[model samples]
Target: MKHEKRWAIVSLASIPLVMTLGNSMLIPVLPTIEKKLNISSFQVSMIITLYSIVAIILIPIAGYLSDRIGRKKVIIPSLLIAGMGGIVSGWAAWKMDNPYILILIGRVLQGVGAAGAAPVVMPLVGDMFKSEKEVSKELGVIETSNTFGKVLSPILGSLLAGLVWFLPFFAIPIFCAISILLMLFLVKSPKMKKPVPFKKFFKTIKKIFKKNAKWLIAIFIIGCILMFVLFGVLFYLSTMLEDEHKIEGVKKGLILAIPLASLCIASFVTGKKIEENKVLMKWLTFIGILLSAGSVFAISFTENIYFLISIFFICGMGIGVALPCLDALITEGIEKEERGTITSIYSSMRFIGVASGPPLFVLLMKASHQVMYYTVTGICILAAIIALVGIKPKEIK
Candidate 1:
């Protein structure tokens, strides 16, 4: 990549990196918050869940607005709003006797801001480069940054919270501020000519779906399923490590990051190789999910952490390869004019997965290990079947 292109990717990539830091970083700190506020586990979870619930509702709206006005026009303001949300949550946690409801409100605002920012990135990247290979490469880096954030979130969250229980909350705006500065200065979005008229935009979307709904729906469902299993397993691992294995803080974070690091490496590699090969992308994704299912099945047979870690690492690679393939498939298949809206819907479904994963995992964990792995493996198999049937290599172009 040229200096300009590298700068643009760097700036655009910061959005997801920062947004993830704001959310996933909280996971390790949730127990601390529960203790600090004397809140229940369910209530502490609300602090995380409410953010995704709000994002799910507003992302498509932001997508439409980005298409109408311009990507930067929407993104900058959204970043500022998200930063403000961090300030609100931080202040509440810092000052209030019971910051529970206030923190939830702040997270809700953060979700609103997230709707406009990170979800817009796929469309923005699609608009940036002309070469299919270049888009795939950049998106690979972007996805790597996201998974890298996950790798870091637990350790960072635990570290910050160890110093001050609310430190993680205050850190959100700082992360956003840095990303905003990079975006404002370095990123240059494509100029929008005459946008589709408001009167006809929805009709255009309806028409696009009419023509492409099969693949679109498949992509959406599989994306949701991937995240659902990813987060759910991560949750289960985090708790199992902390509660069962008598691990805590950075030690647990490091152990948790093992699988995620595999995920990051796999996403980067797949993104590079799957460039514009619709057949390769389709089959890689199909095989990745199947591999993930098989790995989950392996975990069903193991009670050992060391063995489970290795198994989870394989599962991470499976999810890693599938994610960017799904992203590329969607971005490449769609028209640029409607990319933001369609991709936003994709992002929303992803958040839906993140939102539902923890609670769903909580419910499933009451069952035996066989039941848990069986259920997750079933979702993975279903995702594989969706790719096999719904995603055609011919449709990728």
Candidate 2:
């Protein structure tokens, strides 16, 4: 990659970092919000759920729009809308005696913004780069940047929420604004010479899926399952520490960052190595899911924090390795014109996982610990089976 291109990747990469910050940063503070707002635990989970629910519905539409118009044009305005949502939620939290419903509304707008923005980055990265090797390397960096956000979100959310229960909500616009400025001035998206027409767009998509549906559908399911497991574990761990152990604030955040750090390292390493080697990517996906399943299954054997942390870290590492391969397979497999739409569908599935994780975990926690871990492990087993059988390198690459 050229120096200019590297800078553009950095600018584009910042979008996910910012978007992750806005959403994941609030996890630690959810208990605080529950107490302050006098809402139920499920309601606190709804704060996270509604955002992804909105995004899940609109992401395909945004993907279609980006394909129709252009990436930057869609992304810039989406950032502004997301920022505006932050402002609304922040104002509601800061000023109103009862801010729960209004805050959910703000999150809905943020979800709309997220629909148009972050998912578009995958296709945009594919658009800007020409070489498969470069795209793979850069996609790894993008994934790392995202996991890094997970690493930062808890720490930052804890710090801010310590000052005020609602401080993280206020911080969203500031992060989004910075992302906006970098995107506006620093990044240069490829010009679309001829946009796809509405009538032919669905036709093209249908054809792509018809030809590649086997691997594509497998990749989508794997993506969704990994995210669902990751978020579910994180939610379970968060509530366990804060409510059960009475762990609070930055200490809790730092503890949360451990598994995320393992995940980040795995993604960064695998992203560099998996370029164009469809066979290696296939095996990695299979092996990564196996690791995740085994780790979660190990969780059923112990309640010790040290042991649990080690197991979860391994699980995170497996997921981290698996995701970039999925990204590469899908991104490299699809044409540039169709990349945005297909990748957006992939992103939407991932969001559905995120949307479903917390609430589902909350309910699952009511059961035995064995049940929770085993349920997740079962999902991982399904993902692994899909990866092994469904992903044919000859077909995808």
Instruction: Indicate the worst ten consecutive residues by lDDT in candidate 1.
Output: 361-370
> Residue-wise lDDT of candidate 2 within 61-131, one digit each (tens)?
88888887899989999999999888898899999999999999999999999999999999999998889
Compared with the true structure, what per-residue lDDT tens digits does model 1 show for residues 142-202? 8888888888888888888888889898898999999899988999888986897876888
TM-score for each model: 0.97, 0.98
Please tell me which predicted candidate would have the highest TM-score against the true structure. 2
Cα lDDT over the full model 1 = 0.87
What ranges in model 2 sit over 4 Å off? Answer: none
lDDT of 2: 0.90
- Candidate closest to the true structure, highest lDDT: 2
- Cα lDDT for residue 105, candidate 2: 97
Each prediction's total of clashing residue pairs, residues at least 3 apart in sequence or on different chains, is 0, 0
